[model samples]
Target: MPSAHTKSPRAASRTPLIEVTKLSKVYVNDAVETPVLFDIDLRVQSGEFMAIMGPSGSGKSTLMHILGFLDRPTHGKYRFLGKDTAGRTDDELAIIRATKVSFVFQAFHLLPRATVLENVMLPLLYHPTIPSAERQHRAQAAINAVGLFERTNFLTSQLSGGQKQRTAIARSLVTEPQVIFADEPTGNLDSVSGIQVMGALEKLHASGHTIILVTHERSTAEFADRIVHILDGRIASDSRSHSRRSSSGLTSLK
Candidate 1:
């Protein structure tokens, strides 16, 4: 886990980046309804880094999907930036996801034939507000942030594992989203590459991006300001990082 040199910014009064109440999920297969997450209540402050941890089949991934708006909860209300998302249409959710949220996956999901810069620029294609030149500039800046400016022209296949992952990080950040969701970010990397990718994530968090990472690795969970542990579809524990202590001595994870 990486530690921050500067303290995170305090949240303004009466606003939460994420809010979940009585959230639950059920999957029905072969006429059998299987519950995954049960009555989960969670809140994430603006610019906070949170990690979700659990063993396989513990429903951490299911919870993540709900949080990311990739799936809807069976019973619950989710408020993102004070707006209830329960009744939002797929197009509405897509709009929010495109403009406000970005995602990075365990596998570098870059297009195989596209150059690093091009791959990073792909997100901007959805934004009619940005011009082509500005998109390229933003993409280059994102690539540079991950220390891959020189390799921006290289194809994904031409890069090393670490470099490819860095490109993925760059692509995620190029959209300048308010929040980022990363799922098992280091699961597919070697130790050295994993460390590098984790370092990049830490850097992004340090820059005040709200991040939610879903991973089973304790070491990876340590990078977050709060770690929410799930088991058998329920929240087992929620622990805060040592650095996010409040003036009154309360911490986010606690």
Candidate 2:
């Protein structure tokens, strides 16, 4: 249900970035079937901030995996940008995941020995389209987006937990994805660091990146424009909320 204060869904006029209907997932290991998601239906419009919140073992992770193209649904129809994704091959999906979508997780996933700039530039190394001469400039721009320009040369191992996560964000942005899947991005940080990371996410949203966050914290979920709750492999509630907490701790990257 829409809250009384909930405005119409963001980017209502924009094309849908993702659409899924009757989506289901089941694992068959040694012929032992284990169902994970059931008859799920969801649509995400372009330029929106959405958060998926649920307790452990509630199938949120599985749902995210399917949504992010990491795992395939056993039965369902999924469309990306109005095109059916059901017929896509593994290589096609990989190409989409590599060039169109990005991910940020609780783990920093940075190289201890690599400087922040090098780490951010890593993705372009595999991209056949990017010119080597432009990679550094692109990487620097991403680091600036996440407010890590000053630390561009710092080693990942020497940074604080929050800084490391921001570095991860920079890496995610280097590819210029249309959508980002952030799974428990704040799970490993302290309270202050968590707020900073969330603030960074908010800043990104303001810049027109579609954000899909999965978290167990209400405070973090509240940051998003809408929240979807999952329980027992089913969606319990899907509602819009405009309750973004104050980004008081935000710092200027400039």
Candidate 3:
């Protein structure tokens, strides 16, 4: 029998959720152009777990920003769900981000004084369509998914590093986006805490969420089924290979 992590044939055949062709990014300051990424072509399929790995100057973080619609590429054809995003205005991009994109970062960014439940529901507060009354219900569902339900009502300041990260994951999941961008999510964590977070991400992938993780650590990238490496602002390699220790072997921190 196929496991939950297995993508259905139908899913495999669908149009890629993200397609970037000849993508390039250049920053302009005082009329000077600083090139960051160049002619990058990539496709991210639905239900795939992929990691982007690179050193500090490789521009991976910039690529992540472009992928997440948090920033726009200077030149490229970027299609999300087969529709071109080149013409989208800043507000349109913001709408799309709010409605269809999820982000997890190294910084927990949770409200220090807010309860876990409140922090998780913060995204919904800005959503224009999600009913106010349904906010709590949706937040609860996301908290449960990340296995942070036990800490739902606890203040974020009271949580440990791992717990805080879990809370952040739940918060990101609250919007229920199709793709998730994790930017060096374990950068601030210790080994044990990192394992817990990776397992949580693996469980998310097993549940069919498309995960696009950005990391500088090989150990962290191993958790992904596919690893794409960037060097000097260009793709050095993209291998669907990993040396991940078995996920089942790790004791889940949540």
**Count of residue pairs whose backbone atoms collide, per candidate:** 1, 0, 0
**Candidate 3 structure quality by residue, lDDT tens digits, 1-84:** 212332565655678888899999999999999999999988888888989999998999999999999999999999999899
Whole-model lDDT per candidate: 0.83, 0.86, 0.86
Clashing pairs in 2: none
TM-score of 3: 0.93
Q: Which scores greater on TM-score, model 1 or model 2?
A: 2
Query: For model 2, how does the per-residue alpha-carbon lDDT over 1-254 read when each residue is reduced to its tens digit?
Result: 22232234544555578889999999999999999899999888777789999998889999989888898999999888988888788998888887888888888788889999999998888776889999999999999998998999999998999999999999988888889999999999997888888888888988888899999888888889889999888999988875667466333421
Model 1 residue 104 CA deviation (Å) reads 0.8
Q: Which of the numbered candidates is closest to the native, going by highest TM-score? A: 3
Provide the clash count, candidate 1.
1
Cα RMSD to native, each candidate? 6.3, 3.2, 3.3
Query: Distance from true position, residue 93, model 3, in Å?
Result: 0.8
Question: What would you estimate as the lDDT of candidate 3?
Answer: 0.86
Q: Give candidate 3's error at residue 100 in angstroms.
A: 0.7
Q: After superposition, how far is residue 147 of candidate 3 from its true place, in Å?
A: 1.7
